[model samples]
Target: MTTRTDSDHDFLASARRTLDLEQQALAALAARLDASFEHACRLILACHGRVVVTGIGKSGHIARKLAATLASTGTPAFFVHAGEASHGDLGMVVESDLVLALSNSGETAEITALLPLFKRLGTRLIAMTGHSGSTLARHADAHLDVSVEREACPLDLAPTSSTTASLALGDALAIALLEARDFSPEEFALSHPGGTLGKRLLLKVADLMHTGAELPLVNHGTSLRDALIEMTRKGHGFTCIVDAEGRLSGIYTDGDLRRTIDHHGDVRRLTIDEVMTFGGLTIEADTLAAEAIRVMEQHRVTTLVVVDTEQRPQGILKMHDLLRSGIV
Candidate 1:
């Protein structure tokens, strides 16, 4: 047995209140978007080199995420800790690079200390801060205000709403730059090769489909029993029927076997062309594996015939193939 206390109720209430405050903060941040945001996006897009993001503490975490979002969305970007910028890491910034600095107060000593070096290197700086009048904001080429009326913390000291606002603003900038650059899904997938999106975007039918001898192929005149043997041999639950010219003519699956048994007393006496489905669903070798999944799901089938431009049987794709390849 367990007992519930007043402290438990208070804890839940506090969490709900924190979420509400952060939601309001994001709403306010969205309403405060202005020309400075546009200028920041334009500056990053125009940069010939990378967008170097730097910050310290909680703001550093947000800056690292922003750099990752920017890099994956077609913009070249990386993160550098502001505290380390003074210790030779500042060499990473060049005149061709654009710097994005995050600071809630705009008075972070480590970040502000690099202002003179940034000026000397002539690297454009975009500042995200709560105080527009702070030194970092004043010296930056563009200042994005990420201010919040109050923190979600009960004491209003911890960075809660302010950090949320900064992170949302950073995402807005990354997405805006993505749209301006006309970034495509294929290009985004290239940057995230190890992710699920990369697998769906890059894996094609030809890459995973069983080809040549592995394909369950039979002549159109093959007996139903022979066709079943081929299906069992390939273990794809289906077999492809081809014409004399080696072109795909039809497909026969396990379901057809059940139906034939119900309709015909002896399916062994029937020819494959008489029982197999004619001109079944087929996909080209170059089609994305994701598209093949969609076709399989839409038709309620587990296998598909892969064909060439001439309609010749090239290969076969199965649900197991998609599952094994992680495209499902």
Candidate 2:
């Protein structure tokens, strides 16, 4: 007959203890970083072939995630289940490949069984384990100790803190290799084309802009009524006013039209040059679409004129275009 309050208190206390244990384990792993860690990074960096990550059970799950992180961050990598490797899956490992093996006890029979074959194939091995003196660590070209003092589980048998420590160490390795290769956001985007980050990084102004006949354009000497007609036809909420040389000189929007009628009381009496905003915000066609959003937000404008190096209007970009394309 435990009370509801007591049950709630116990639940919260268990959660806090679990988090604290995992945090302390990560701190210990960080302090243990030494020449072995550097050597592991160098081996992965200099690897001629892909990094093949292998493990069993919970360690296998961490190995898969680490492989994915390494591949997406610039290093070529893939995961192979250790139990499957002794079968025909060992063909996936080659002479030039680097093997990253993970195990808490450092004595996974499935992984250890392949050590002899790996040696014969001349494959390089890097082991991450809790036991530094284990067979896997002793046979590895480099060893990273992801040892944890104790598990966060009350029974102290589950792989809670150990798995977290191993995952964090794997992330450190991926990011270090990423920086070493000068991997850019653009390259990362290429690896993740279906993601939001890819859309933001790969989308250029030219890709989203309305070009040619889609552009709302009028000559500087055109009447305000004619500019309004052009803007209506293009549905961009604005019209670009070009000089005699066919270069962008100014812009006029619906806001300008409203202000003109309020101030002058006669839209027919004013020309585009007389009412248009001079030297309006413009962006190069090759600019990133994310940068275009920043410019529009900063100036409080809904439209941007895409121009070339010669300042000639090539197309127009509207807020709706960005919103429709998910660039916003």
Candidate 3:
């Protein structure tokens, strides 16, 4: 156990106050949306090339995240350091690009220095800053005002509330542009093929469905012992039973074999139809693999048969298929 100190209490109070101030700043930013924001959205929506984001210091980091969000949401974008623009990296900006310049004060020396060139190159400029009347804002094609009432920092010298408002403004632009472009989840998935979301959206049931010879299949008249042998041989712990017309009749699993043995006291003489769970345990082949996982979860079953419109067994899927797809 440790003793409490007045200094620690004061520190906690100050931190709480700082958080309150920053939260209020963000709230103000959210409530202050105007036509300029819409104008910025339209500018980005009409762009033929990428949205080039640039800022200095803390704003630069936020710019990088903004660029990433934009790119992920169907708006092509990348970040360029304002500090590098003066050193011939300015060549990266093309007439087709839309530039988003960030400066909390709207007067960062490095960023302000780039305005003349952006104008000369005919790049569409959108400014995110605290002061709409600042030089940077005045030179921009559209100015997004992100002014805050106060800084959360005790010294008022550090960028706290100002940066929060700017970052929120950046996200507002990214998402607004995202909505305007009608970016779909499938489009977003194409850019994120390695992440969990990518696996969920980009990958479909067909990509991982057990087709070909790996499918555990048997005729409707298969004996329980034979179905058990097929289930064991396939290692999917299940088998699909079909009729002479190739229509799916039922599915047999390890659990069904156990239950059948309990009911008949012998697997050798029992037919698979007597042991298989009926219509309740099947899913469509065209259904999303994620949906298949949910069906398995809801029924507490591992095996599912993918059937066509005629209720014919097309393929077999197991909990392991969903697991391998990273969708479970």
Clash number for every model? Answer: 0, 0, 0
Whole-structure CA lDDT of model 1: 0.93
How far off is residue 246 in model 1, in Å?
2.5
TM-score quality measure for candidate 2: 0.95
Instruction: Estimate, for each residue in 89-138, the C-alpha lDDT of model 2 and write its tens digit.
Output: 99988999999999999999999999999999999999999999999999
Question: Which residue pairs collide, candidate 1?
Answer: none
User: Residue 70: error of model 1 in Å?
Assistant: 0.5
Which candidate, 1 or 3, would have the higher TM-score against the true structure? 1
> Which prediction has the highest TM-score against the true structure?
2
Question: CA lDDT, every prediction?
Answer: 0.93, 0.93, 0.85
lDDT winner, 2 or 3: 2
Kindly state the number of residue pairs that clash in model 2: 0
Model 1 ranges off by over 4 Å: 1-9
Would you estimate the TM-scores of all the predictions?
0.94, 0.95, 0.93
Which candidate's lDDT is highest?
2
Q: Write candidate 3's Cα lDDT for 237-266 as tens digits.
A: 778888899887777767766677677875
Off by over 4 Å in 2: 1-9
CA error at residue 203 for candidate 2, angstroms: 1.2
Pairs that collide in candidate 3 are none
Q: Please report how far candidate 2 places residue 13 from its true position, in Å.
A: 1.6
